[model samples]
Target chain A: MRGIILKDLYDNFCIPKNAAFYIFGALAISIGFFIPSEYYYVLISGVILPLFGCCALKSPTEQEESSSFNKLLITFPNSKAQIVTAKYLLGLGFVILFNFLALLWSMVQVYTHHTIRLTEALRIWGIGISISLLFLAVIYVGFFLLGKRNGTIFFITITCLIAVVWGASSALLGIQTILSCSPGLVICLIFSGAVMIVLSCLVSIGIYSRRYSTGTKNRY
Target chain B: MDYAIQVKNLTKTYKDFTLDNISFDLPCGTVMGLIGENGAGKSTFINALLNITSAQYDQVTILGHDLNTQIKLIKEDIAVIFSDSHYELSFTPLFVGKMLSKVYKNWNQKKYLDYLKRFGLPEKKRLKKFSIGMRVKLEFAAAFSHDPKLLILDEATTGLDPVVRNEILDITREYAKGKDRTVLMSSHIANDLDRIADYIACIHEGKLLFIRAYDELQNNYGIINCSRQFLDTLSPDDIAAYRKEAYNYRVLVSNRQKLKSVFTDVWIENASIEDIILFYTKGEKIR
Candidate 1:
């Protein structure tokens, strides 16, 4: 499992995807504030940021190993479950790294505005990370289930669900309830992130537990 | 004795196809050739053994590791290669020397360098640019660099020119002579198998058609050529498979020596893997 992650990270972050990510991160910090602070930035981070993370899925170079190696892996003295854990953990590490960067950028936005104080900047950063974490959960599982191609559809579905929740809570009850519920936002965000992570983990583990090989594994 | 691989009643199901039941054993230090027509479940069988499918129903053991557990350690000594062209030299020969050493604990840098130079692969070119033959050699270099005890080749010689194919087969044959390792190769090319495979396993329509020592498999089956009228007397089941030309007929039989005696007047010819596949496959269509 460690070997798998080392290979993926080597292929992804250490080399290929890292350059793009660092450049994207720097660019996001430079240009994210051009639009108003609320929905535009949130949507971009919630949606586009996770797409970069999804592309980081480190599959074997062979895509799928033949039965000889398949048998080799299962009987290799390490649990396939551990293999799953290492991959997920490596993914989580990348998510954390990305999460912190996005959070820092969001805080800078909060600090640039005189309305929110430094402490409020931290609170907003916390909420941003929570939202990104939730997005990661939903997107990662979506990647596992729907695959990389159908991920955009999954994110759009999640977006629709979030819109419905926001609409129902604000429209049915009025914006007064939202103002009153401001203090509880972080908890709510944490709960949402937890649910998405648990849901994605369950689905991903189910896919991994079985010998699930996807894509055109045969080279020719 | 610790076998290189042992499979019993391994089954994998798909929507359109099922690798019905596959069982074979490749003892330590022997190569087993898996031969089947395209989509005949040769790749599927390999996939199942590799635990690639989600509907996991199988009993497979490889490299003294039980398929149900110990997958990682088992993987440590195993290498896999696919036949496309020369394998990608993603990194330079120098870079591969260092990077691969990190993956395969036993990777021998000098041996890898020797293979790269011997194969005439440029250390500087990224594998994406190499010819098919060069790419395969690089894959062979990487695979052997680790000093793997068991090598699983998935159609590694399928589409190469005869010269390149022969070279690849010779490398594997040389690898086998050390008598401490095994290679399981899947190929659509029978001639490649005929030249090197010690054992042969045939799969047809998702079933283990037969697994036999290559010498025995070849020795057992022969073509019994006869006219249409004479074919009427033979039981269809006795005819494993057969083909028909304008005036002559080519039939594949399990006991060719005995069948020749039964049809004493018919001509019998030596059977190759292609003949057996063509005979059975074409015969099934006619029947």
Candidate 2:
């Protein structure tokens, strides 16, 4: 499992070829710096952070499919459970990293300009982490179940649907009202996201194992 | 005798094709060459053996371990190489070595580095920058470094130049020098197998045509070239398969010595592995 994770990291993140992705991440961070403090959490946590997290989770699966590395992976000494768990662990690690960065940036904003309180920033961070976890769960399940091309389409469609619904709800209930109720809502989201993530991991392991047994090209 | 790989009643079916009930055993300390034409299920067979593809099998035992219950343990002692390199293109050989070192318990870092150096592979150069031949050499280096008990190659030398292919064959031969080591290489390139194989298992249209000793094939099998009238005189029991030409009949006979002694005037030539495969695939059944 450590070897598979290391291989994925080497393929997707720790390589010079993916320097462009790092630049994109830096650009997302820089873009967040200029947004109004009141809307900072909205833009960074709601949009930019989830988008970045999704890309982080998606790239390794895409590379594995394009290169047929998954076929090679099954030949390794690792079990199917180990292979599926490694990807989930990586996704969880990225979600934590993204949340940490968001908190750090939020601290900078709070100290530099006293617009948002630290406690409020923490709440926003919690919500952001929850949303990212849910998003990761959905996309990971899609990639493992539907494969690369269909999975990408499914993810994009789901993202668009969520955006449309979120926009409609925000317009109807108002942004300030949503923020006021978010403390309790954030807890619910976190609990639901954690459950979804666990379910997604188990489902993915079953899907992957079935693919090998049935000789289906589910991911590869 | 101990077998490195044993399969019984193995079958995998698809919408268009099926690898029908096939069974064979690759004895320890020997190279078994699997030969078949394109789309003939050589890869499917290997995949089934490695549990890469789910297939129905009554029994499959590799290195004395049951394949279904103990594949993970079996995988640790085996190395497989396909025609294409499965390593990440962005990774340098140095990084690959580091990554795989954590996967296989028996991975030898010094031996891996030695192989990379010996193969003239650049440690820091990414695999995408290397040629196909170079990438295959890298895979060989990795396969050998782990000291696997069994090495399985699926058309691993197909696209290489003759020189590099010969070099790989030499390395494979050396790897099998260990008394416990075995190799099961599947290739349409009959010449490579002819040089190194101890047994030849021929598959034609998803069926096992024959699995005979290489020595028995060389010494006993013969292609008889004779007129139609002369062919008619030979017993059907002696002719395994035969193809007819414009003016004569070419028959594949398994008992060359017996046939030669019975018909001293008939022209009987030694059957190469390629000839045997061609006769089996293209020749009509004796019946």
Candidate 3:
């Protein structure tokens, strides 16, 4: 667990592209927030981060490093579960950090009259991160379930399906009216988001194990 | 004592190619050079040992641990270095120092710095911009910094200029400072392996032709040049493989002395690993 965090933070994120990712994320999120749009920032960050993140995972150039690093990680004196946990935890850590930063920036917007109140901001973050995690979940499932090639395509397809569903559902049932009067909406959304994140994460774990077992047979 | 690596009935079937029943062993503290063409399954073999992709685990074990259940333990003692640079090549070397230090339990900062100085790599320069030789040097430094007992290298020494290749070879030799250390390397540059590898395993078209001590392979294997009339006098069983080219006959033999018993027209020449591989895989011209 310690090993994965150290590698992800130090080896992966301390360089040029990493800074670019955070900087671009901040810029993209800021643009969405200041635009006075309906779920624009939330939607953009939700769709873009996961979409690009999956692309990053399957990047051909990244394979040179990933395969080697993964080789090192598997060989370490730890369980695959531990390695998986560490990687997910690191992903979790980064996502949480991004959430905090996103919240802080949103708070600044609220202070300046560009965004919603504190409670609304909290709800937005909760929903936003859940959507992003769903994207991540799809990415994980793709990598571990179908191998990198099929996985990227599957992830994109799933993301597109979600977008289509969201658009169609929103057309039929407006989001603002549902949330305007009911306090229960906030609690239900939180519970739903939490359940989705946990379920997606767990499904990814199952995919990862099955993938490893299959890989073990054909590789040797 | 059992060999460090033990593979029994190991097989992998790809759609187009099959790595069929591959098996070999390296005694502890010895270096084995895996020689093969580009698609000869060298990387596949290394990947299998590391348990990277889904590969057979029940039949292969290293360092006395079950490959399936004990891969992590094997990996802790074993280090792998591929030709590609794994560290952030765009950061200062110091960043590499910090990044790798935390992951490896026995990470030695002083040792890393010493290797940097020894390899003549700049500490402040970003690695992505370094010369290929320097990048390779940095990779070796990091792999060695961790106190690993086995080093599995997949063409890690390929493409470097000769002098740097020699330097890398020397550094690999130093990593074996302790008698218990071992290295398994796959290289196209036979000269490099010829200098350092104690054992040689030649793989071609997903099959292992042979794995033997470097000295024995070099000493026992030879290319016997003979004429058509002479070839007619010799039997196929007397030679490993004989080719009838336009002007002459090139015969590969396991024992050079066998040439004397053949027709007097036979001319036996000492064969290098390259010669053995070329003749074995492509059927080199005897003339």
Residue B40 lDDT in candidate 1: 91
A1-220 per-residue lDDT for model 2 (tens digits): 8898787776667765565786777796787687656665555765567656655556677778777878778878988889999888877877887777787777876787665777677777777777888888888999999987898898889888877866886789776665566688888998999999999999999999888873321121
Local error of candidate 2 at B172, Å?
Answer: 1.3
Task: Give me the runs in candidate 1 sitting further than 4 Å from their true place.
Answer: A10-18, A31-84, A102-116, A153-184, A191-195, A210-220, B54-59, B83-110, B122-124, B218-221, B224-245, B248-268, B280-287
The parts of candidate 2 lying over 4 Å away from their true place are: A15-17, A34-36, A157-172, A214-220
TM-score of chain A of 1: 0.62
lDDT of 2 by residue, B53-171 (tens): 88888888899998888888988999999875378787789988898898999999999999999999999998889988899899989888788999999999999999999999998
lDDT, residue B150, model 3: 86
Computed on C-alpha atoms, the DockQ of candidate 1 is 0.15
Candidate 3 residues B1-287, lDDT tens each?
Answer: 45778887666777998777788878888888999889898877777676665554347778887787677677667777777435544556776687667667788999999989988888988876798888888888878888788888889987889888888899888776676888999987788788888999988887888888998877777886768776666556556666677888887877766565654555678988888777778773333
TM-score of 2: 0.94
In terms of lDDT, the poorest run of 10 residues in model 1 chain B is B83-92
Rank all candidate structures by their TM-score, best first, as comma-separated numbers: 2, 3, 1
Error of 2 at A16 (Å): 4.1
If both were scored by TM-score, which would come out higher, candidate 1 or candidate 3?
3
The most accurate candidate by DockQ is: 2
* Residue-level lDDT tens digits of model 1 in B1-287: 56899887776677898887577788889889898888898877766665554324445678878655655676788887754323223334555555566656777988998999999998877655777788778778888888889888989887688899889999999998876789889988888888888888888888887778888768778877778777677776667776778897766777777777787776778888777766655575336
- Which candidate, 1 or 2, would have the higher DockQ against the true structure? 2
